[model samples]
Each structure stands twice: as structure tokens, then as C-alpha cells.
Target: MQLLILLQLTIYFALVLSIRPRQCPKGLNDANTPRCVAMDGISDVEKNECRSAKHCCIGRNGYCYALPRKVVPTIDPDKTNEEMLSDAKDIMRSIKGGARFLNIGPFPSALLPYGGEDPYPGFPRLPAFVCHKRPRFPDNCDMEDKKALRYTRNPPLNIPYCIRIPCDPDLPELDESRTKCREMPGCFFDVQLRDYRKKFGHSVMAGVPVCQLAIRNKVFLEEARKVKDKTGEWTPYLNECLLDTFDEIIRTNHEGCKTLEMLEYFKHKPKIAGWKGIKEYDCYLIAGCWMTKKCYYPVDVNNVTVSASPTEHDDKIPSALYYGRPPCQKFDDKNAKSAIESYHSCLVSGCKLDKHAQNSYYNYLFDFGKSMDPSDHWVFWRLVESGKYGAHNLDEYNLLPKHDVTVTPFSLVFNYPAKPGESNLIDELLRPGSSSLLDMIKTGSGLQVPPAHQNIRDRFLEDLQGIQTPCSTTFTSFGARPCGPPRYKPTGVPNHCPYRPIEDKDLKPLRGSFEGCCDITLCYHPKEEIPNARSGAATYYSTWSYWTECSATCGKGNKKRWRRCIGMDQSQCTGRTTENESCEIVPCSSWNKWSRWSKCSLTCNSGVSTRTRTCKPIGGFCPGPDEEIESCNSEKCKIDRLFGPWSEWKGSCNPCGKSIYRSRECEATTCNDDDLYEIQQCPTGCGTWSSWSPFGPCTWDFFFRTCQKTRTRVCNGKNGRPTECQGNSVDVAYCIC
Candidate 1:
């Protein structure tokens, strides 16, 4: 049973190792390690613990890696729940306070005024409802006493109020047809007669009686002309007579006659049968209609009395009369005693007339006089407005002062005074002052005159000249410098040649000149040959030779050899050839004929035969080919082991022995076939040193007057001796020759 239990434990251990903790049951991993699992399956207490641990862990990690235990204290469940709750409440309060400090409260309500009915009745009054106090009145109340309260306020009092009440519907409506009158009503004549008497007074009735006669004449003439045949000339003649009579009557009586004539004429005339005549005789109607029709009544007055009061002055006399031939009344009366008398009386008495009365009298005259001349009314009306007497019969009013008048381009004439406080009219036909001949001369002569009398022509010309200079003025003619004849020398002129002399202290010289003469020609003189001080003497000759020697010896081509030859062989030996008598050619079998003869043999006798042979004639003779010979077998001679210690001779020689020659001490020479010398052992007199004969010594002269020897001396070197030892007295020495 124990083995089975052990076996089961072993199996469980293996399974745990094989499966990862993530695949294991919850909380089965090491207790020290945090197990991430679903919170839903855990108890509330466990979840709470886990959350607290998580918060603590997060807080510790955030605070620079402090352990969770150091950052948060362990919970003590033994403590009362109230303590925990109180701590929690404190934390919540801190969070809430922080939120409040950040102004994170619910968004503030909009600042707009609230929209709702007012809680209290009329709490805030509208601007229109506010009342303003009335203005104060004066203590005496003068306006009130006169019932002139209307002017007390800034704008007048609204006394009548002028309220527009709607029209009354209950009352009978007025007939729109009655608004316009086409014909006279039955009561119109009576109304007009009563109104005429009220307006003009009883004296007007006197004119009315005359006016009726004129009316009858006018009617007869009109009817007579209409009824009569076109052939009868009497009718026209009678018509003229009747018209002239009517005009006479109208001239005598003005307003009252004109009114009555107009009424009767319109009443009787066939043309005006349907149209209503004007009952109230307005002066405008008579003036306009009579002037248009050209039917002047005889009794029309040119000037009537414009009285102040009609009732008191009904019998007053007229100021003037209309009288001319028959029908047309003269604007100025030539023969009318009453009209003349009335005008004289008006001039004598300075009487004032009412405006309406004056207007009525003028209208009558205008109607009567305008028929003769259409412009008469316009001229007369202007004169009346000017307060001047315009009628021919009346005295002149003369209201305007006397003056000379100036007319502007606008046709408005200003009355300038010839004397102060006086004026006059200028005629329209006159020319403007600018173009007037009189004005032109007065201005052009340049005469000083009064301030007001300066003519426009002079002023205009002066202004133009002030702005523009004379035509002759130019840049050169003005005070400016001229572009004159070319200047002989530079001169200081403004913007022309304005250079000033530069002081030496202020000016810097060019480079490389102490005395400021940097020009090469000015500073340096031309080169000339230098003279020799010791001329034509031995010292001069020797110096010249020395310089020439250096030039020749140091020149290219065997410089060292040439330098060695200096003073040693001032005369170089030239090679000469004479036929050598001792150089005899004998047959090889008889070569031993001469005393110092060398044997030339073709073959030897058998078994070393000893014989002192003379020059013999052998059957055949032989000669060897040419060979090379060198004195010193240096690299220049192209012979190996021919120089240095193994040399046959050690000094220079005139003629070398055999195929050998001296190069220098401790050196040798090589032989060639064609060489003159044959190969032989050097004699006892020749030293065993190399480099003999042509290879006497290696010496180089570099630069001028300097000689160098390459080989070291084996013995004490002597001058003028070859580099070999011949006897005890003559040791070979390598000297630079």
C-alpha cells in the first residue's frame, strides 16, 4: 500500500513538471507567485485582497521600485470595521476635494437670463411703461392766461389731438357726384351778389352798373358777328365799335365791373351753357381768361384803390386808369382826367394798402393791360414785388438804391455801389465783365486801384506767372553751373571736378617702396659688366686661368680625367704609329730566328725532343685568332676577377707583358685576341697589387678644385709614382694623379 502511494505521488510529480502552471488548476502554482485567474470564480474576500495587492504593487512600482509591503501596510482584520470605513471615507473626501480644486464640477449653468414668467406681479417694468415728469411752468402763468398753453411744451400742446376717428357709417353717405359743380346752382347768382358787396363795399356797386352796359354791348357784338352773313362787312365794323365801347367801360370800372362782366358773359354765352361759371370772382380767373380770350372790357381800370378797410374807404379814388383808342387800353393813360387825378392823389398821400386789396387791384390791371402787351403783366408784377411804381400813371416808388450792378456768369446780378449803400440793375443784353472792353484796358495797364476794383484779367495772369517761370529760364541760365568750354586743368567745382589734393600723410604708398617709388624703371638702374681690379697682370692672368680651368674641367665629358690631367700633362701625348721592325713575321717552323724571338709552332716532335731550333721552314704554319687585353679588369672593362688582389702587375707601365697589364695595385687586367701584348707572368719588378697601367688609380674630382681618391693607401703614398712597388726604394702608392 505504501509503494502504491509512493507510485501515485511520483506520477503526480511528473504530471506537474510536464504541464505548465498556466495549464494547472487555479492556485496550484507556488503560493509566492501571483496567479492571474478569473475574479468571477473567486470569493469576494479574495478578490478584494487581490485588488488591494494590485493597487499596492502598482503604487510601489510607480514610486521608484519600493516593495509593496513598504508602500502599503498589511490590513488588520482584528480592528473594527468602523476604522476601515472611516479611512475609506477620508480617501473619498480627498479625491472629491482634488476634483473640486481642479474645477471638475458639473459644467456651470449658462449665464443667460432665465426664460419664465415673472414670479411677482410686474417685478421688472418695460422701458416704454416708465413715466417721465412734465416740464415746469412759469410762475406767472402768462401762457395759461392767454390760453396759449400750446407753446409751453417743446413741441406744441396737442390741444385738438387731431385724432382720426373712423367715418360714421350710421349717417347717410354723401353723393360723390355733388363734389364737382358743372353748372351754376339756382341760388349761385344771389350768393355771388351778396359776397361781392361784402368783399368790395357799396362803391363796387357803382362799377356794377357800368359793367352791365359793357356786358350788353359785348353780347350784342358777339351775337351780331355770329348771325351776320360772311359777305356783310358792316357786321365786323359794328363788332369792332361795340368791342371798343365795352373796353372804355372796363377801363373806368375795374374789380366790380370785371366780376359782373365775366358773370353776365358766361351766363349769356352759348359756349358756357353747360359749364358752371365761377361765382366768386377770383382775380386769377378774370386775369387768365380775359388775357387768353383778348376780350377787354371798356370799364376795366388800370389801377384801382387798394384800401386798408373796404367799408371805410369804399368811395376812395383809384390810383390809375386804362385808356387807349377803343378796345385795347393803354398801360399809361394819355387822356383820362379821373385816372390822372387819382394817381396824383395817391402820390401826394403816402397810404398803405392791405395785401389782399393790393393783389386784387393788380390782377384787374394785369387782365386789362396784358391784352395789349403780353409782357406787361410780368413786368408790372416784378415792379410791384420790387416796391416800385410800375404803372404809367402812378408816381415811381423808387425803393432800390442807385448803384452800378455787376452780373455773374449765373445771370444773378449783384448791385455794387458807385457810392456806398446804393445799387442799380444791369441789363441782360450787356456783356460779362471778363470780356468787356472797358474792363480789359483797366486791368492790363497795371494801374493800382481800389481793392474792389481790381479786374479779373490781371489777377488771372499774375497767378499763372507765379506758378510758372518765364520761357527764357533754363538750367544753365539759372544760377546753376554751366557745361562750358572744356577746362584746361582739373578744378574743384561742385559735382564737376570736385577732387581735393591728397596729403602725403593721409595717402599710403604701394608695396615694396620705402621712398614711395615702386615703379621698377624708376627704382632699379640698368645692369652693366663688373670690371676686374687686377687687369693685364700675372695675377689677373692666373685668376682668369683658374676660372677657365674650373669651367673646362667641370664641364661635361670625362671631367675627372680632364681635371687629373691638369698641370700633370699640360700637353697630352698623341698616339703615333711606326712600322715595328722587331715585329717580324716568320714561318711557324722557323720562328726562333731572332735573338729575342718567340716560337711559333704548328706541332711538336715526338717524346719531348730537346732541340734549339732556329727559324725553320716547316711544311705548314699556324697563327691564333685575335684576343682582348685589359690593364685593369674593372666593371668598365667587362672582365670578371681581372681587378683587385689577383692582378699580375701592380703599377702603371708604358708597355705591358704578354696578355696582361697593370690596372692598379691589388688589381689585374684581361687579354683579348687582337691585343698587342701576349699573356705572360708579370716580371719581378711589377708588384702584386691590383689596378695597374690603364687602371692606375680610381680618382674623382667633384665640384671645382676638389679631388677624391676611392682606394685606401696600402703603403705611404708618394707623388708622381705608379700604384706598385718596384724595389725597396720605390713602394707602389695609389695617388690621385
Candidate 2:
């Protein structure tokens, strides 16, 4: 029920999710731009006037340009070449996954202080980046470089948010930001202008639709999750699979993020959500207090002790655990926006949102369970007010009344800090929600069906076409660069590397003609079509064919690889002709085994009890199936089978296909939206026939004197297509007219 409510309550999530292009939020608009002529009905004179003044930035950029930024070395221009190389090397060394000399780039003007003191710090900050410029920047002689990568502070420029496949907390620095083609959106992931200026030319096109790019991202995540499940970490196989998945998705929209059927399938999926800007997404959904600068959540979630009012002092207390101040950033940074974009689930609330998602509840109008009382169901729905709900949108906290903070359920989505005696919030949330943690994927990882790319509908192409002039790089006028690609191009690289550098040797143009650029990433079996020759034995075994694609995108599906015989001897093909692998791509709602007919409610205790199995999901009220069982006053008794309702009808009609079908949750359980419920017969492109009247009394024709029985039937033509009832509405036999 909660899931159903969430689906409906979030209007945009329901109506404009799948195909809508990313629209510039009303709050994010710039008046100096050409929005005056934004309306389709605007007069041509206005359009011309607006074009002369400025390109409209009403969600779509009126201009498309990839003008390059001036190159600045880590060291000053006056420094020796050796010094320049040395300092840049140190900066690179500080990063983890991306190689120091290869991928690290355009450093922030000033380095953010190392976050050694962050409440939940990962490995101590390493000093390799521009930290050399900071006063008293720590350094080690025989050192490992980790400096300059600070999570506690925002960078001068937007750093694309890394795509987290496995949710590794220690490797946030290694996200795909560096792997991207240098100049994004305009450059598309196809090429990086700044990075590849010397090697490959910068000419590229964002011809790929944002929709397709989003789908590729989703496929990578799905493959990433699968690889993690098997290897416990990222692997060459994962990268290889990613490359393969991308190639496949580009060809067929079947496994895409926006497939017609998949959108519907994912509407009820259990998603891992969190407030924007935080690193960890799987935090506990608990009540917390909000302030303009900081949100006060408990360090210990299981034993949450946060009060409505918390004294900002004494960091040791659970209530005092709040987000420490991050480096101040310009309100218009795209990195922050990317962080929010990755979690399209949070976009509606994020529109015009600030550095963090604090007062976003202002956008919503519906009443929700209040903070003071979890059971305050008497609340009524109301629009937040006529204005944007972002930090920039408001000059002070007064713009968003403090009292209104407790209204939306969003207050419950805080990032809880972990302590020695404290339990993990994620574990707590997952305990009752998931059957297996392995089935889950990160919220922002573009894998969820509808809501995944809901907000990424950047009608980039539409906007580009609207303006007659396309993005052509010019000397002075730089076309508006698009937001970076939401994901790294899935060409298969190592943790911190790009496809060209870490790709498979065999996959290269000349197949490893150059060194250090490619390696051996491929499938385990590397199955291919059966080779023609069997060299040695009388009847050698034929190798297996490639595994077929999984049967289902979400939920359980299967794949198979098969082999055949070489010679005339069929038996020699040997061990097995085929192989089967089960794939639970993404889990769907399912019932757990019915609890032993309630032993306490007492059937198992020799009294009448009920057996029930709940529909498993993180959110929403799942009504369990209950059946009364008799204990027979013994230790055990026969349990009655319980069932849930039938699922929606699925299947198509015409060309001798089943019109529709439906299945219910049974067996051990409880569970139609079309009923081709069988393939009986084609509808003859004709009207349905009604029963004929009893045979007319026996009558004899005057000429032949033969007694004949006659019956009449009616043709019920439907939808004004009475002609479909071809022959006639009535049928007669033997009797003269």
C-alpha cells in the first residue's frame, strides 16, 4: 500500500517518467537567457529578437559548443619541466583507481583540505594533489600519494559524480569522473576534448540520445552487480561484460532501461534511496532533525536518541552527529547536480535544491506522517507554496518555515553515522525488507526501470534542433556544453582507468600493438561458435556456443551454452549438449514461506492458528496471505495452502498468438490487469455469434416437399464494425423465404 501511494503521490514519477526529456526546472532558469520566446507559440519576431540577445536556456541550451578551457599545469609556468612533472605526478599518485599520469585531470584551482577528521573517515587523506599549495599541507618522504582528494569539500568545478557499482565506501575517488571524455555532453562520451587534444582529435557528436545513453548506464550497473556477486569485487570480467552489454543494448532495446514492459515492472521495485549529496545511499530511514546548515541524525540508528532540539556541542552524543561543514561551493556547480541526477528518484525534490537536499519538502503538497508522532495520519494535503524549494531560491531559513521540515517522510531519510556500539542503518533497513542483500543495486546506478532515468529527460536533441545553429566549435563563441554524461562509456576499463587504456588486447584495433594500454579482460569460458576442425581423436568433442542472453531483465531468467559433435558419432559430443544458468537479474515482490500456521495464535500449539507469507519489499504495506489451520492438539498438523491474487494479464493478440494471460501467487502462497488467458481460435475478424433459436417447426418446401429444420442466430458486431459480421446477422436452413 505504501508503494502504491508513493507511485501515485509522486505525480511526475507516474506521468512523466519514462520518455520525458530532462526539462530545465523553473527554479533553475536564468532570466538573462532567451526564455521570453520559450513558448512554442511565441511570435517569429520575438524568436528572432531573443536569438539576437541570447540563446534561451529554458531547459535546453540555445547554443551547442565545445570550446576548450585554457590548460593550466599543476606547477607554475615558470617552474622547471621536471618540477612540473613531479608535482603533477604527486597529484596523480594521490588518487586510487585512476592512474596518476593517465586519467587525473584539470585540478581544482585550490585543493580542499584533507578530511582526516571526518567523523567516519576512510583511509587517512593522502597528500598528492594541489595540497602542495595549502599552508602546512602534510607530506611523507618515502610516500604513498593520497592527498588532494577531499570528500569533505566541494571542488571549484563540477566533478562528475562517480557511478558506484558495488557501493564501496573507501573508493569514492575512483568513480568514473576521470574516465569520461574530457569535454562532456557536447563531446558526448565518444571523445574527451581536453584530455585527447594531442592524441585523438576532439571532433565528436552527442548524436546518441540521452535516453539511449541512460539505458547503457543501466546495463553497465546490471552487469556490475552480477560480477560483484560472483567475484566479491570489481574484475576484468565485469568490465568485459560491461562492454558486451553496451554493444548489445545499442543493437536491441530489449534490455534497455526504458522498455515498455520494464517500466511497468519496476514501478514497485524496492529501491535504495538517500538524501542528496551523501556518499552512502543505503542508510537507515529514520527520523532526524534538520537545520539550515546541518541535519542532525543519530550516530547510532538502532538506538536513535536524537531529540527535536539538539545542542550543537559535544560531538560524542548521538543527537549531535550532524554533517560537518563541507567546503563552500558556488550554487551553480554541476558536480552537485550530477550527484542529485544519479538518483533520479530524488530529482523532483532536488529541483532548485541546494548544496544539500534540506528543505526540498517545500515542493510537495501532500500530508505525511509527522516527525513527532509516527502515527500522525490525520494530516491533510497542501501544496508547499508558489516558489522553488532550494537553498539558492531562498535568502534565509525563513523562506522555509522550520515547522514545515517535519512534514514530509523525507525527514526520515538521513545518513546515520556509525559508532563502535552502533548497528549499521542499511542492515536494519534491509533486515525486514530483503530476502537477500545480493539482489539489491545502488539507487543512483541507473538500473531501476522507470524512475531510474525519469529526471534525465534532457531533451537535448529537441533543444538542439529547435535552434537552427548546431554546436560548432568557434574561436570566440563557445556553444553551450551539455551536462556531463550521466555515466562512463562502458568500454571496459579497470577501476580507475579508461577503455582505451585498460581495454582487452584482443579488442584493440591492432590487437595490443602498443603496450600498457590494453590487457586480458574477457569472459570465463570465452565461448564462441563451434570450430570447424577437431584435430586429434576419432570423434573429438565440439566446443560450446556462446551463452544466450538472459531470459528476463528483472526477476529470474536463464542462459544456456551448447556444444555439438564433431564427427558422425553423436555420442562423442559427450559430456553435455547444453548448459543452463539461472539469472535473477533483479528481484521482484515475492512471498516468503507462510509462517507456521501461527503457533502462538496457537495452531502449532494444538490450537487454531493461521499461516501467512508476506510480499517482500522495502517499502509499502504487503498484506500477507492467511489461512486458518488446525493443530489437532498435536505437535504438527496438516497446513492449508494459501494463495494470492492472479497477476496482470500478459501476451499479445493477432497472427495466431494468445491474446492475453495471467498467473496468481500460489504454492506455498498467496498473489490481471489482460485475460488471452488461451489460444483458442482467431476472432475470424468477425462479430461474436449468439445462440440460434430452436429449429423452426418442421416445414416442407412447396416444390420439393422435403421437411427442413431452420435455426436463426444473431451477429453482435462491436465498435461500429458491424460489417465485420460478414455473411449475415441471421442464418436460416431449409425454410423458403
- What TM-score quantifies how close candidate 1 is to the native fold? 0.11
Every candidate's lDDT:
0.24, 0.28
Badly placed stretches (over 4 Å) of model 2 are 1-167, 170-234, 250-352, 355-737
TM-score of model number 2: 0.13
Clashes of each: 52, 24
Q: Which candidate has the top score in lDDT?
A: 2
Write one digit per residue (lDDT tens) for candidate 2, span 1-737: 22322222232111112111123333332212222221222221122333222112123323211111223223343455566556655644443321111111222222222321233235232222111110110111112223322211211112111111112223332223433321111111212222332244322111111111111133345545554565565422123223322332322222211222222243211111112342221121111122232222222223111111111222232110111111111132234333322222222111111212222232111111121122221111111221212212222323444444233231132223334455544344345533322232111111111222222212221221222232211111222211211332322222422223222333322111122112221100010100110011123332234456689955789988665433333453346677899987657666666676554432332444457566665322244543546545545433463433445656644323424656543333221312312233335344566776776664554443333455677767557553244434443333222
How does model 1 fare in lDDT?
0.24
Q: lDDT of candidate 2?
A: 0.28
